[model samples]
Target: MDAGCVTAAHRVSCHTMNADLFKPTPERGPHQSSGTAKNARNKPEQSKPELAQVVTDSRTGRSYSKGKLLGKGGFARCYEMTDLSSNKMYAVKVIPQSRVSKPHQREKITNEIELHRTLAHKHVVKFSHYFEDQENIYIFLELCSRKSLAHIWKARHTLTEPEVRYYLRQIISGLKYLHNRGILHRDLKLGNFFINENMDLRLGDFGLAAKLETVEQRKKTICGTPNYLAPEVLNRQGHGTESDVWSLGCVMYTLMCGSPPFETLDLKETYKCIKEVRYNLPSSLSPAAQKLISGILQKNPSDRLTLDQILNHEFFKGFTPDKLPPSSCVMVPELHPPSPAKKFFSKMAKSLFGKKKSKVEKIPCEEKEDRDISKLVSGIVKCSINRQISYKTVGPSEVTSPTGQLVSSVPLEPTPAEEESRKSISRSFKGTMASGTEPCEDVLTPAAVAETAMKVLKDCLTAMPAANRNPPCLSRPQSFLWVTKWVDYSNKYGFGYQLSNQNIGVLFNEGTHLSLCDQRQTVHYCLTNNKHFTFAANSLPEQLRSQKQIVELMANYMEQNLMEGGDLHCEEQASALPPLLLQWVKTDHALVMLFNNGTLQVNFYTDHTKIIVCKSSDDSYLLTYISRERVSYTYLLSMLKEMGCTSELRHRLGYVVQLLQHHTDA
Candidate 1:
């Protein structure tokens, strides 16, 4: 028989071979032998009354009302039972007397109850009181409403890396506790890792648990879910804490890869594979994950990673949320760790500016030209104009107008009058923001800003020359603004970026933006792209507190985990406001960010190459490129246009333009 059949028999009869569990009892027919009919008639009738709705404990004389069935195993059925007097609920496992009539079968139930009731740990399922009636034995356990990891795995075939880390930490904690107490959870699998309503994991199902024994005296019983069984147990050597660790590895593999590593159509094949430590590690798994799995799944039981070693593995060194949201039971969770940086910055801010003296300034829809000009300067128009002029040499046919209409092919060189008009627009835009005196009615709207940026990038890519045979070596500028670090958690929260000026910004998935500026003492929030708000870091409004927290989490994550992408540095400048992200586009190959301060950044995925274009304070265009080696070089756009760049930089710029065009088309 296969391991499944063996497990079924073990559950039904406490390891006794029982073929009757797999098939129904046959009914006697007219042709049946008279002796057989007599034997059948003498046997007790299997049918019985439905279990009493109200079960009274004979020992304690306590009455309980049974609710709906929770689950069932071969030897018992579990129900949600409430104490009639106290109105308290419990998960009651009801095992019928008929199932455990044999002395050894009854001993198994007693052993499980005795072992489980003595356990007390946060990760272990709580054990309540137990009692017996004439017809059933009721064992109460902690109620876990969300069910088990098995249910979650069924809903989400595989979990993300961070989530895997989150769950594995808890599982290892519980396993370590058991090991410390000289006990073994022989059956370790997704089905046994119960999840409570609070999203906390509790290791339950101790039916197969046993006290640790010396190797010579250990019970060589091959009992556990077949797919998770250790080779030593199958070889009848003995069960040890290492066997449980091996099973834990299988559980981890099942949760991460969506199936147990040694699962096979034939149970024998599975056992064979386990003995040989044969399994395929998918390339999709991170290197840390692969290493951890391999470390724990070693063929020799002694070679397997201990619970402590597993917890300290490199895989766990990554971001593991302290807790998971309850929604994670059915869907992916949007988890944001409490920001460590927020507290540090808050303390520093209090020392620099007294807590009572800090102020919050909320800009209204209509403000003075100077006040609004500050907002405009920290907004999108500057970068749009710089990008527009930087690629003015592109032929009209290849350029897209700000309105997204295709330009007609014509002599693309600008006439003197047109050149003068372009210069006038730039000067006027900058002068109004600087002097705060000019009332500019031609302010670009959010939609117009996005369109203009797209046009400028497309034009630049179309006009750039083909890649050169060698990289260009030229004297570059000393300083410029660009992204030094960034992380894409777009699957949950958003895309986070750190500027060379020590400013951090997160372009959220919901179309809003939050930024930390002024040495992280001030916060800037934008909604619907145009409406902006500012707050003292320590005194943010209740409505924006959650977003501020999320930005801080991203900021802390990048500060600790990610290295700066380039060496170019721009020291913090004294400004009333910081630049806000106007628009961001993500492609399979790269992430493109556009800022109101006239900065455009494109980060490529495959090689970690980056291209940044922005206007310098000198009314000149600057382009910065960070190569795959993380070396940074900054040049005037005029220089690049005249001297040309190497193929590496040229191709990435072309890709950014293509992505913009595709985004516009979409």
Candidate 2:
């Protein structure tokens, strides 16, 4: 195999050089004669198979008709061939198995063939046919008119935001299909990505793909571009489908920002950067784009966003390349490099005389109010800390600095102001901490304790457990005062809320913001004094997110149970409220109504002879009678006003009103 061939096989060492490899003729050097120079300049690039003269059609075993080569690798040569049989041009890849002596080479080729054979997706490169001739094996594929994404990246310098969205979506769609079928394209990089004539993407070369039924079954073999490899892969640890997601994220950064995130001339330095998980988002990209990238680049595979999540991102909304601005006028960060997008190559320099002086310094700490308060209360408590350094042999060693001396020190006492701050921190961190331990730490300094406490508070606020947290439902709980007073005067209530309705210009708006399946989707609801109310459809419960559907479903089910021969009670305002259980009402949808204790409920017109039970303690559950036909936003708003709803209810209704305004204006 040629040294230039980038093989995806896990065991195929890219480090080996084949002795039989062909090198560019020396006569074409820059100092050569004018004729030689012209020939050298015109000499076809090794990667461009379309420029190579056809020797023979390996598939037919007959003298080849005229066509050009499109791509080439070590053991194989691919040409854009005009099939004499059907007069159609197709890409034919020719590889001689005997010439490929690299370990796992056959396995790589077989994997590619098998993966292509079983998978059928619009965005993936299609395998049309395969067979062997006397001298080589031939695998025919669909012809791609445009160059590799690498070539496009070089030519355009950097892709615009819209172009990034347009291409990434096509690739992710193909990947989603592959993942759904239990396959992982272990090697996903810009070089293997093809752009078709229609400006659509075609994922190419599945040589390193694996069939993964379980997370443990995923690959641990290291085979990917150094710049794009995930941290887990570089550390020689096992990796899964999430590794591809990380690589794809690198590809996305390249497309949108014009360079792989972790890039430097120093190989070890680059590796260290990746290992430490360092990447910066330029201000040129939108916050949403940064957030999506951050989610994809999460270090823990379990936390990374899947391909489907990328498709649903708001960043790709209305993306199209036909609308791209001129190349010279393209907006990009000033830090982006000049292109022919250079590969990550080694340029280590040997110092002739001596090493340069080091200027590294310790990271300085800045003192701020919230930070100080947090540190004072939270700093070293609950955190694993050893006061003294010990030079022990085999048993155990105490924490120490490089100087090898005991480093025990007395913890400072907090100032009166910081002590007051500690009181609040104790309340915040107490919930999630193991039972029985207080925030008491003897050694922490006043400022340090305050800062630590703030940190603990921040962690608590960010990682609140679902059961203990009051989740933001599709809408805020209708004010208890508003509901009680309104329900007393009216026997019949009627109103409808549209799903994701966001066009009106109203003061009240209600909805749920949830993170599900590593993606974010919103659900909405509109409640009014008229007992008539409508909820937006339900959505799936995603990780670390509030699902309105689950809330509504639990509410409705409980309401039905109460109406059915179940118990019911409207306890005193201060009494313990009923526990809310969120049920799955529908995919991408859910219902919310009153549920007393464990019983369920269903709300409907009484003409059908079905009893309706209402539970007052279940604030989590609210009843809504959905109209058979989707209700318009304007009518819903008018109903709310007619019901003489309070200002608080009106505030929750603002979101629906905004939706109405958006549509009417549109």
TM-score of each: 0.46, 0.40
How far in Å is the alpha carbon of 84 misplaced in model 2? 3.0
| Model 2 C-alpha lDDT per residue in residues 1-666, reported as the tens digit of each score | 011101000111111112222222221111111211113234543342222232345445543222444655444666655442233556777777564447676666777787798777888998987766455666778877665677677666577676777678788888888888878786787767787666567898765677874555645566656677788887767557788899899889877787788877765786788888798899998888898898888877778887778777777664344423223233442323223324222112224434555768744443332353343321221110111011111111222322233222112344565445455445433332121112124322212222332333233323433232122222432222111100000011111111111111110111111111111122221111100111222421121112343433333433444222111212233222212111101000111121113222222121111111122344233322222232111112222222333322222222222211211111
Strongest candidate by lDDT: 1
Off by over 4 Å in 2: 1-66, 101-104, 318-666
